[model samples]
Target: MIVITALLIVVVLTLAIYLFYHHQCRLREMAFLMGEAVRNGDFTFRMPRKRMFFGERALLKTLNDMENNIGRLTAQNEVESWEKLTRVLTHEINNATTPILSICQSYLASPSIKSSPYREGIEAIHDTTSSLNIFVDSYRKMTQIQKPDPVELNLLDFVSGVACMYPSVQWHIDISSAQTLFIDTNLLRQAFINIVKNAIEAGARNIGVRWNRQLCISNDGAPIAPENARNIFVPFFTTKSHGSGIGLPLSRQVLMMQGYDLSLAQMPQIGFHVTFIVSSTCGSC
Candidate 1:
């Protein structure tokens, strides 16, 4: 009777183990299906809610909420970006056109001024048209970023190469040998150049590149005002006298396309900081 009781206990344990394994397999299958749906842009397709263990139920709910959040955020960002772009473009075009119109009307209204004196108005129109062309070309460049072709790179080499481009400024590099990342070399180089130039223009005496968990480029320059910092990422928003203001915004767009993030921060210590976020779970980044 004791042996029979022992055998019965063993049988019960085996049955429980098999049930747990089956449940795990189901979970994995569900996860895969959910992933596929998300990849295919089927946000409306949701997993069936059913009575399950607390852990599994909670996990599924979390995933559902994530899908909804992502969808909302993506839509909101697109709308905001386009709205900002439109505002900047309209303002720039009006600035260019208004001057040209006023100058031309004045030139035409004065028939006696059709002599060589009118040549000044013609020159003004030419200058304004040239400036407008330049603005349009810059806008095109901002909107039409080429698809990035990424390659693995050593952090030290990449940062050093960019720093070397600006020999006039002092550079402080602190990166580990093991710190490597994958990025589009050409595109990232452009972004880095823009930031370096911006720092130099901001009167930075020394620039520092450091790699802890994420990459940070800092400059010993005056901190940006709270108001300016808020609009720093907006296209055509610049405090510089001659700044076209597309540099930072375009750099950010390029980085975002490559599944990375860039942002400006003012550290308590001193100087302006730009953070490059590299996510561990972002396989493409």
Candidate 2:
């Protein structure tokens, strides 16, 4: 009987040891993945917290929260840096190009130079300078965006108003929870308009908006091609022939300045070909 009891005790001890090691192995694997995401500078990657031991769950959650904070701060910093750079570059570019444009125009106004070969060269210079000036001016205007003045607004009301602007398109609005968010009316309206315009340009006949822990806008439009997805939010990187390439970037900038986030979700999100997500980092603001 003593030997039998000793054998049972040994078996229980071995089982406990195996279970402890198994849990530790899973924790190491998850920690390795989280470290990889940080090293790659991809803070958007998230780790699962479910089905984990108490200690493991706490650690995973803490890591996820850190990632979220890092991503938000990084976005805000990028927007501020871009705005300062735009201000300086636009000022210098306009200063340098304006005089050349004027000189070329003044010379072209003379009839004697019309038949000269140098006339064509001067004209080309004028044309190029003019284009540069226009581009610089457009970017300069973006830097003048007003500081946001947030006010509490009904999400459904605001979004419905946007849909009303385009009666031709089929709209699906679902913010049945009727949540109120604090945001700048005009700026957010402009951002939403930009998004809707892009959807229309992409040949979308149906658009859907819903609230599921965040605001999601989906469209049955042409999906973003894989190759172009990486640069879709990059300033001045448009795939369209006449695209200014600043719509998404500007939208992100405005939202970022106001402590909000704007991102494009992976394909087929919530049964739509294209999805845009808007989430808040500022609570009660």
Candidate 3:
């Protein structure tokens, strides 16, 4: 009887070990598939949950949830990216062509164009078109910027410079400490400009800029609606009719490329807040 009991215990232990190993193998396979899916940008595939194992089923559900979220975000990002490209193309083309067309019309209207003065106007048109082509090409390349050329910057001075561009909006600048930041000056400036423009567009009377551990730009404007808040970072999603919806997304993208984070947060008794997460050590100096 003792030998039989001992044999039964051994069988149970062996079965448990086998089951654990099998479960681990399944997990390993799932992890591999997930990695492949991420690399291939295929988020539609899902692993079947193990009904008998509650823990395994929970993990599968969590993974599936993550997959769905990633898929949705990816789709939105792609749509927004395309829309941003379109807006830039349209704006730049119009900017380049408008002046050229105006010049041509003026030349055509003047009786002097029929004389010996037509060559200069034609030359001007050629130069303008050439510049336009160059700008469009450069703009296209700018969209694919993978990284930023960082330089040390005085935080307050940089923010102040961007704020100076919009004189109509009242600016309140605060610095907890004199912090020098390492960032891409041009890219970060453009990002700041976008944020400030958004504040001005939102009918902000007073815009506040502060730097401590991070940079916080707040405006006393109408708060974003709940639904709009969720998609505020989405590319090409705009509240304004003429809004290309590119400003916030582009700013976010630039910051992200520079290893920074930008977000909209609410402050009690205050208005809309846009925060930029920078280096912590830089905050003290």
Q: Pick the candidate with the highest lDDT.
A: 2
Candidate 1 local lDDT, 139-243, one digit each (tens): 767656799999997889898888778898898888997788788888888878888888788788888888766677788766677667657767778998888
Cα error, candidate 1, residue 49 (Å): 30
Measured by TM-score, the strongest candidate is 2
Q: Please give the clash total of every predicted structure, in order.
A: 0, 0, 1
Q: Pairs clashing in candidate 3?
A: 178-285
The residue-level lDDT of candidate 2 at 52 comes to: 84
- Each candidate's TM vs. the true structure? 0.60, 0.83, 0.49
lDDT by candidate, in order shown: 0.70, 0.82, 0.69
Q: What TM-score would you give candidate 3 relative to the actual structure? A: 0.49
Best first by TM-score, ranked:
2, 1, 3
Query: In angstroms, how far off is 284's CA in candidate 1?
Result: 12
lDDT of 3 by residue, 112-220 (tens): 7757567676767857776666655544533665578999989888877877788898888887446777899998888888877787787788888877556777787
Candidate 1 lDDT at 71 equals 41
Pull out the clashing pairs in model 2: none
Model 3 residue 68 CA deviation in Å = 20
lDDT of 2 at 79: 71
